[model samples]
Target: MTNVLILGANGQIARQVIAQLKSSKAAMKLTLFLRNADRIKDIAPADSTIIDGDTTDTDALKKAMKGQDVVYANLAGSNIEAQAKDVVSVMDALRIKRLIWISTLGIYDEVPGKFGEWNNKTLGSYIQNYAAAAQVIEHSDLDYTLVRPAWLTNKDEIDYETTEKSEEFKGTEVSRKSVANFVVHLIQEPNLEVKHSVGVNKPNTDGDKPAWY
Candidate 1:
C-alpha cells in the first residue's frame, strides 16, 4: 500500500479528502500532521495515523513523514516558504518523491483583470506567501505537482477542469470539496505527468473562457 502523509490535516479540504478516501475502495495507507488532534479526533479512517504536530516544526515533520511515499501539503500563511523548505529538507533526506501541494490562483499572474483583482483583495497576504512557497517546491528535486485553485469555498460538487500553470484560470471559485477530491486522485493514480504545476476550476462555470483570456 502506498503510504500518504498529509500536512495540515485539520484543514477543511484535508478533512473532506479523508472522508472520500474512507468511502472508496482505494488500498492506501494514510498519515496526517495536525497541531491539535482534538479538532480531528475520530475523523480519520481506522487504519490512518494521526500524528499530532505542526509542519513548520522540522523535527515533528520529519518524524511524521517517516516511511511515507507521498506528502500532501495544505498549509498556509506568510511563513509558508520557510516551512516548505523545511519539509523539502526532510523529503530530501528521506528520498520521498511525491508531493501534492495546494497553491492559489494569481500566484504568478495566472489571474487576470477583475478576477485577479478579486483574488488580490480576498487572498491578500496569503497569496503572496503561497507564491513564495511554490518557488521552494519548483527548485527542489522531489517530484511535485502544484495545484493552484481559484477562490475557495465550501460547496457540494465535482465539476472542474485542469490546465497548464499560469494559464488563465476559468472560474471565479472552485469548491473546497473539488480540491479535496483532486488530492485523492493523485494518491490513487501516482503515475501522472509529474513535476509541473497546474490550475483547476469549475467547468462551464466561467463562460467557456476566462474573461481575461
Candidate 2:
C-alpha cells in the first residue's frame, strides 16, 4: 500500500482533499497529522491513519512522515514557513522526495495587474510567509509541486483550470473544490505535477477580485 502523510489535515483544503482521497485506489493509505484529533476523527476517513500532535515537534512529525511515498502540506496561513520548513526537514531525513505543497497565487509576484495589487494588500502578510516557504521547497532536492491557488473559495463546484503560472493567473481565482480535485489528480499521477508552480482559477473570469468571490 502507498502510505501518504498529510500535514494540516484539519484545514478546509485538507478536508476536501481527504474526501477526494477516499474515492482513490484502495492501494493508497492516507495518514493525517493534525493537532485536533477530535475534529479530525469526526471527518477523516474511517480507514485512514491518524496522528495527533504538533508539527514543530520534530520527533513526532518525523515519526509520522517515515515510510510514506508522498507528503502533502496544507498548513494554516500563520507560521506557514516554519511549518513547511519543519515538514521539509522531516521528509529530507526520511529521504521522502515527493511533496505536494499548497501555496497562494501572487506569492512570487506571479499575480498580475490591479487584481494582483489587491491580492497583495488583502493577503500581504500571509503571502510573504508562503512565498518564503515556496523558496524553501524550491531549494530543496525533493520533487515538489507548488500549487499556487487563486483566492480560495469554498464553493460546491469543481470547475477550474490549471494555468501555466502566467501573468493572466494573477487575476484568476478558483474554487477550493477544484483545487482539492487537482490534488487528488496529482497524487495519483505522481511526478506529473513535479517541479511546477502551477496556478488554478476559474476560466474567462476577470475584474475587481470579487470580494464575495
Candidate 3:
C-alpha cells in the first residue's frame, strides 16, 4: 500500500482530500499531520493516523513523515517558504522523494490583464511567499508536483482544467472540491506526471477576478 502523509490536515482542501481518499478503492495508508490533531480527530478516517505538530518543526515533521511514500502539503501563510524549507529538510533527511505541494496562481505573473492586476495587487506578499516556497521545492532533489490553484471557492461541485507552467493561466476561480479531487487523483496515479508546476481553474470562468471577489 502507498503510505501518504498530508500536512495541514485540517485545512479545507486537505480535509476534502481526506474525505475523497477514504472513499477510494486504492490500497493506501494515510497519516494526517496538524499542529492540533484534536481539530481533526473526529473527521479523519478511522484507519488514518493523526500526528499533532508544526510543519516547521523538523523533528516533528520527520517523525510524522517516517516510512511515508508520498507527502502532500496544503499549507499557507507569509512564512510559507520557511515552512516548506523545513519540510524539505526533514524529507531529505528521511530520504522521502515524492512531494505534492499546493501553491497559488499569479505567483509567476501567469494571470493576465485585470485578473492578474487584481490578484497581484490584492495578494502581493502571499504570492511572493508562495513563489519562494515553490522555488524551494523545485530546486530540491525530490520528485515533486507543485499545484498552483486559482482563487478558490466552497462550491459543492468539481469542474476544473489545468495549464502547465509554460502556458498562460486561464479562468478566474476553481472550487476547493475540484482541487481536492485532483490531489487525490495524483495520489492514486503516482506516475501521471512529476517535476512540473501546474495551474488549475474552472473552465470558462475567465474574468477580472473571482465572482465572489
Query: Number of the top candidate by lDDT?
Result: 3
What digit string (tens of lDDT, one per residue) describes model 2 on residues 1-213? 778888888989888988888876657888999897777887777888899988889999988987999888888767778888888898899999999999888777866788888888888788889889989998898999988888778789988887665445734567888899998888887878688888988776676786575
Residue 112 lDDT in candidate 3: 93
TM-score of each candidate? 0.92, 0.94, 0.98
Comparing 1 with 2 on TM-score, the higher-scoring candidate is 2
lDDT winner, 1 or 3: 3
Give a tens-digit lDDT track for model 3, residues 86-128: 9899889999998999999988888999999999999978898
- Residue-pair clashes per prediction, in order, are 0, 2, 0
lDDT of every predicted structure (CA atoms): 0.83, 0.83, 0.92
Q: Candidate 2: worst 10 consecutive residues by lDDT?
A: 164-173
Candidate ranking (lDDT, best to worst): 3, 2, 1
**What is the Cα-based lDDT of residue 201 in candidate 1?**
84
lDDT of 1 by residue, 15-46 (tens): 98888888989788889788888787778888
